[model samples]
Target: MLATIKNISVTYDGVGKSFSSGDFISGRITLELGKDCKIDYLSIKAKGKSEVRWTERHNNTTVIYHSKDKMFSIEQFIIREQKGQDCNVVAPGTHVYPFTIQIPQQAMPSSFKGAWGKILYTLEAKLSRSMRISSKARAEFPFVSKADLGSIPELMIPQHGTKVKKMKFFTSGKVGMDIHIERMGYYLGEDLNVVVSIENSSSREINKYTLYQKDSFFARGKRRVSTKDILKELGEPIPPSGKLKVTKVLKIHQHIVPSIFTCSNIKCEYRLKIVLDVPYARDPEIKLPLVILPATQTSGLQPPPYLTLGLTRRERKPTRMEQHTTISTAPGAYPPTAPGAYPPTAPGAYPPTAPGAYPPTAPGAFAPPPAYGMYPSLSDFGGKSEWEKR
Candidate 1:
């Protein structure tokens, strides 16, 4: 009978299959058999790896360069050797098996997709049969390791850079460009606001201006770079003395990796580069560093309470005296004191005096304390009188 793998389903912590490093992955494998069959064993495996490869032509010959990093590899057996027989014969309609694995806690690079590079995670289930090829089912998912930008102090401030270059070789005068970014730090899927000013006093005509987001990768000491044009604007030909200003909002893709710092063998970073294309002249370029942050953490300039100093100070608890003092002086804390600094007593109630001292209480002589919710007199607390100090 023919053997076939029906389907495979993977889940992470009762949710979607997507997961991060150090997460527990659980899934089930399903198989269908046409008839009774003999099988050796069943197994499930998971792997996470990254590979970078490219081909270059050298003197009519093609040479390939490749590098690989195995972030993790693990395998577990769903069915092992049978207790009473060399192989197990199954009369199967459908069979299902479950598996669970824990990903390592070490920093795992985010999943990436490129023309010559990929960081991938895969799951496979296989059935072994003697003297024949094994039947297998496979599935692939993405795992992302988020980089936190809240720890970087420099990212909180705005980023600015300016460059001025003099035209050379037949072109005379100077061209200056200024780039200002709202902030150096950003989260994926967030919009980046950029302000650019170009002052041209040169004879060459400006063709266009382009903004590129570059991802630089260092793997096994080999460097690979990829760039995407996030913004482009056609430049109007400026006279010998003219200026142009541009304001743009560029969106960052959510599937990209944040700036990586934990891994030595595999490193990634991003930069914002501006290029001014000029006809018959060398293009002038300016690059500024950018920090991609994880969406799991809040982005943008947070209120001052979350700043570095505030974060550190938040850990300290206020002393008892400070708490009490603050509570005592807080507005609306105590009822307002009555006029003359005396708290009115209850109706027909006379102030207590030393033993053997007669109390004086006459009708229309003392006013009762103001109705509830009204200000109390200072005498309630012994301020010149018991009622006044109350």
Candidate 2:
């Protein structure tokens, strides 16, 4: 009689189940048998990949667009007998195999699942025996990648958009709106305070304002898009020749996935859209690219606590001059000659680092200029920062 397979399972070995690049994924595989069983081999495989597939129908014809990227795959043998030996026999009982694998240190997109595409990371174990189908168990885990906001100079730059529409058939005059944001990159849980100014010189009244986020997935030169409204406000009907200004604060949802642009087969992006409702005429709209970053990112580019957009002051990268020049502050150190002290440098050169440096500032007194892509001041948000409350 053949032994019966009781159970097969995989379990993680940590308080947190989520992992990131360069992090260890430690776990165990378990197997239980009812009686002594002859085992040929047992193995575990870990894989990360992205896939996108969709079909379009034309007149009596169908077109399919599909693509995939295998980010990584690893396999390890847990139970394998020597070539000269017969199949190994396993006594009836529960057995466990522990494992630890390190995720590759490279650019990888965060785990994502969409209607037309998905990026998945999973670990599976299998047991094979003579004259029996293999027993397999699989488990999925969440993975986050370092979205280096600091390196993307554009993320730190401020953005502005304006749209004006002149009414013709249903109304008269012109309606215009100007939208401004501090920066393009925002961490999860951060509030994006959008400042909007509206001028209604038209005969029709503006009734409402809607702000929403649009998510786009791109694969094989095709795109799938979805939209979710973040904030909706009723506008006190802006009479003709009226002007209004308002600030709307929208909190980035914690459950939303971070932006993914590293994967070529699949790309995920976000856009913030603002629209004004005008009766019987086209609405005025302003759209801006949005970059969503994880709050618990592992990238070494953590920004300072006070400022929302800039990099950390303590871990600030050294300037080019600081990196190439050396200074000896030891006791009785010989001061170099004037000509040699100040090395010929490129334009916009930082002050010399040698003895008698210009602007002889005190230690820790010279604060570096704030990096880009940070939140505005508290006053800009109308009071204490909402993020600081958390």
Candidate lDDT scores, in order, read 0.54, 0.62
215-268: candidate 1 lDDT, tens digit per residue? 444444456567776556665565678887877667787766665433323344
Q: Encode model 2's per-residue lDDT on 135-197: one tens digit a residue.
A: 999998888877656876667878789888888886778888898999988888898888888
Model 2 spans > 4 angstroms off = 1-4, 59-64, 130-132, 203-239, 298-390
Each candidate: how many clashes? 15, 3
Error of 1 at 21 (Å): 1.9
- Minimum summed lDDT over a 10-residue window in model 1 is located at 305-314
lDDT, residue 318, model 1: 21
Candidate that would win on TM-score: 2
Which candidate tops lDDT?
2
